[model samples]
Target chain A: MALIGILGGMGPLATVDFMEQIIRLTGAARDQEHLPMLVANLPHTPDRSAAIIDGGADPLPALLEGIDLLNRNGVGVIAVPCNSAHHWYAQMRAHSAAPLLHIGEVCAAAIAPQVTRAAVLATRGALSAGFYQAALVARGIEPVLPDREPQECVSACIAAVKADRPGAAATHLSDVLDALSAQRIDAAVLGCTELPIAARELARPAFALVDSTLELARETVRYALARGWNRPV
Target chain B: MALIGILGGMGPLATVDFMEQIIRLTGAARDQEHLPMLVANLPHTPDRSAAIIDGGADPLPALLEGIDLLNRNGVGVIAVPCNSAHHWYAQMRAHSAAPLLHIGEVCAAAIAPQVTRAAVLATRGALSAGFYQAALVARGIEPVLPDREPQECVSACIAAVKADRPGAAATHLSDVLDALSAQRIDAAVLGCTELPIAARELARPAFALVDSTLELARETVRYALARGWNRPV
Candidate 1:
């Protein structure tokens, strides 16, 4: 399998969560059987949500630096765990030597197979950017976004998880999911990386949950493993 | 703060555990407040335990390659999550411009503050190399290693974790700890990275558990945070 690269540290904990998901999904019995990963946890990058919503410092330079290092080290495929960072995806991919996986595309593809209507649980910046929305629309699936109140709930939830408070975010998350279930939503896309951590605290929700982080990981693994066995012994 | 670097993926999950520990210890409430980390999750490097005890392929070249990448990328301080890999610590540190944190030294230092007699729960390779043992002795502490049967138990526990079976390893790990407690052991250093995951399955053993992965992570965070803030404004 080709070595996988992760441009992470959008929020350090989310990056860790993404890596854990990849490890879990790989189901490798031996360390060597697991897909090799090179994770650039360069978390000091300016906040993507803040940058897009409130004119914060641009995180593009830092993102480029991380991608360049991964490329220089010869990673075969790269994936960024942060959804908000995908606002600069095209630019980052254009500059990268390796292919970068699109979180939205993967999540949409995963969703298209099963549900027609799904709620997008994401950062306000990512919601405003409409990447996941556009991807689902292109696939002819309806993408439901959090309303202003629910968006505030998501923002608070993400902030709590960033501060290492997964439990604190659970109540608000449950309320958001309850609202979605009321709308007869078929599933919810955990479009933001941090949302998945908060989702863990909830007892299986009323609707199916499509985890964007896990989907990206699953896709990354499939993409890498599919790249032909290491040129045979 | 200086950028922190982790030479990880000796076993990918252990590496993630180490990163999570670092994040937890940093107490960062926001993305920027967290230490900037560059993690090289390059698991394709030959197995450290096999390389050591079985006379398998030397992992020195691979270790050095990963270290060199960290140095090249301007990480101010480096730490390795894998205890067994410390067999080549001196050589790896020698090849890099950045300082590599010693898992044993940090672990022993953390242990010295409270305990005098500590158990070293590690792979056969690490015990044979005597890195943890020597560090404890230098700190004027007694290092208790597993006897032949206990060593096999420790190995089995580590294998179970590597194979993603923490529950299956819990019984044997408890037995090993019970034996250590019989000898008046005050603490046990989880010298193998995988052992920490297995240790989690046990409900606080009678003796203290000194996790080498967590110790290394704490040291790394302290190292980077103390490195004189990234050139004041």
Candidate 2:
């Protein structure tokens, strides 16, 4: 069974959420039945969005350092849990020996066949970079975005979640989801990793949430299974 | 800052819970402000309880593999979240270069000064091995064990949570807590990692629940900070 390395700590909580989802999706009855994972939660990496949008320092070197650690530690493939970090997906892949899993690409591929129209709720960095927009267009799904008012709500909710105020964030995010529902969108993609925590807290009955984190988790399971790392349930 | 290596996947969700707590405890506003972690979630390790109490296969080789992975990966310290896994803490420390954080010691030290009498809710393996009892005695605190009937309930609840039926487990665990409350115990230690999740879902108002997982998380933060990994919030 090949090991899956997670180049994480874009925000530490998201990495924990992604790893939990992978374990839940794996359906393991025992410890050995679960996927073997090497998580490098290097929260010390420079902010991806700050570097991308602002004239901040490049995060590529720090990211490369994490990737190098994973590669040296015998990980076969790497998955980055943060959406904003995906802006550097090309560069990360360019420098790494192991294949990198793009959360947006995985979410797009998983949702493409299911829905014709979708809305994305993510960090300002991801939204500005059109990370999911590009993937959605390539998959033939029309991307719907929130208006300015709701976009502000989205950013605030993301910030609230990052600061560990998930309950408040969930209420505000549910309002954003309601606004999108009013637009009659078929589904919503929680493009940011933290959004899933809020979505789960909202406890809405499966209102067509296309969670990028869960999609990445499923892709992780698929990747491990393809490598023959499957355990009998 | 030294990387904190987690020897995880004794039951994968516990590892996730522990990692998430570490992130929340660190209280970092950005990625770089958080502690770097190297988690080797090797779920293939044999059942700790089964091996300890029921003469199941030795999980030492698997544990050693995980410990060795951390030692080789430049991890300064190691933390194993599962309470039952601590039965082998001595052997694990003996074989590994990185120092091990005894979850029991951390829990005991945290609770000892606050309360004189406390009851423990843990796996049968931990109870049989006298894991927490030894630590509590060392800390000059009285260790209370549930009688056979309540102990069976504890085991059942632990199994239910491991099987992912946290709701049922919560209900059953609440009954165990009530039983302890009837005995007038000052506090109860959620000696098992899964118990804290169940207890939180119960939403009881500050009934003096001492969570070992949360204590371990705090200890993890302290360990990093003592090594000069402190980040300004």
Candidate 3:
């Protein structure tokens, strides 16, 4: 099996969520049957939004450092769980020698066929940065956004997740979803990892919701299995 | 604060262990004080030992793939918890744009002042590959090893860890430590992450031990704080 390396900790809960998904998707009968992994959860990273908006610390150096560590350790493939961090994917790809599985790309590919015009409910930074819009556009899907007031609510929802307040985030996100529904958006893409937990709680099946995290996990499972890492016991 | 990216899962437990240490060391209060991270825990890596001993699949490609992911994400520094994987550090470093933190180097640096001659009790692959010896020598420290019989015991201890048999691994490691004591080595380096858990259980105070996992954690905290990622509340 190939050694999987994770560069994580956009939010601690998101990292845990991703790990749980990996384990559940592996379908291991026993603990030993699970594949080996190398993870560097550096939670000390500066805020992604702060880096983008406030012109503070750039996170690219630290992110590259993590890649070096994985490369040095001989990890087979790498994935990052942070949705907003994908904004720098092009630069990171240019500097890296290893193959990186694109979570945003994977998520876009999965949801493209299912939804025609999906509302992207993410952080103001993510929306402003055009991270998801570009990827969705490439897939020929039109991405929608919440109205001005709900956009603030969506930002608050993202902040609530950063504060580890999933319940509060869900409430805020519920409002945003309602606003998106008012706009007649067909589906909502939970563009942030923390947003999914709240989206799951709201349980509004009135409109299809695309969870980037779950999609990333599904793609990761397929990637691992296709490479024979999920050998049968 | 700089972003710290982790490329991990040489073993899942080891990755968890490292993350726990980072949290403990950070002394974080609010969630914001914690580091922001991006993780991709890939467990599809081929066995490091098989690659070294039996000439199995090379992990370099996979390792690079992981590095690229982190680099693209903009991590400032990267760390991996596996000692055996460090054998490929030089090659990985050459391909990496970010600075990779060296667990072995961190361990060697931490133990250098305390001991002149240290006995290494590690996996057969680690011992056979001469990674520890080479690292210690580079740091101007002399590394001692157990005889073939005791070395076999150490290998058994490592196997017990991979099998998740902490008790058996502890017992075997105790025997190896006893053998090392007879040779009058200054201290024993629990060069493997799993071995530290076992060594702590055995708890032979008479033999000073260098735990690479614990040391790496300490270094990570220091690195984070030094870089201003974590601030006192």
Best by lDDT: 1
Better of 2 and 3 by DockQ: 2
Query: Candidate 1 or 3, higher lDDT?
Result: 1
- Where model 3 places Cα greater than 4 Å from the true spot, the runs are A112-114, A230-233, B1-32, B35-229
Most TM-score-accurate candidate: 1
Clashing pairs in 2: A31-B43, A32-B43, A32-B44, A43-B31, A43-B32, A44-B32
C-alpha root-mean-square deviation, each candidate: 1.9, 2.9, 9.9
In order, the Cα lDDT scores of the candidates are 0.84, 0.84, 0.73
User: Judged by lDDT relative to the true structure, which candidate is superior, 2 or 3?
Assistant: 2
lDDT (Cα, tens digit) per residue for candidate 1, span A1-233: 45688998878888999999888877777777777777888777888988898999999998998899889988888999999999999999999989999998998888746688888999888988889899988988888887888888888888999888877788778888877776868889999998888899889887889888889988987887677322211
Per-candidate fnat, comma-separated: 0.79, 0.76, 0.26
The CAPRI category of model 1 is: medium
Total clashing pairs in model 3: 54
**A133 Cα displacement, candidate 3 (Å):** 1.3
- Give per-residue CA lDDT, model 2, range A1-233, as digits (tens): 56889998877888998998888887765567788889998877877777777867888888888899889888888999999888888989998898999999999888847688888888777888897999998888889999998888887777777778888888889889878877867788899888888888876633588888899999988898778675523
- What digit string (tens of lDDT, one per residue) describes model 3 on residues B23-126? 55665643457765545454455667668877877777867777877787677777777787787888777777878888888887787565778888776777
Which portions of model 2 miss their true places by more than 4 Å? A112-114, A171-175, A178-184, A203-207, A230-233, B112-114, B181-184, B203-207, B230-233
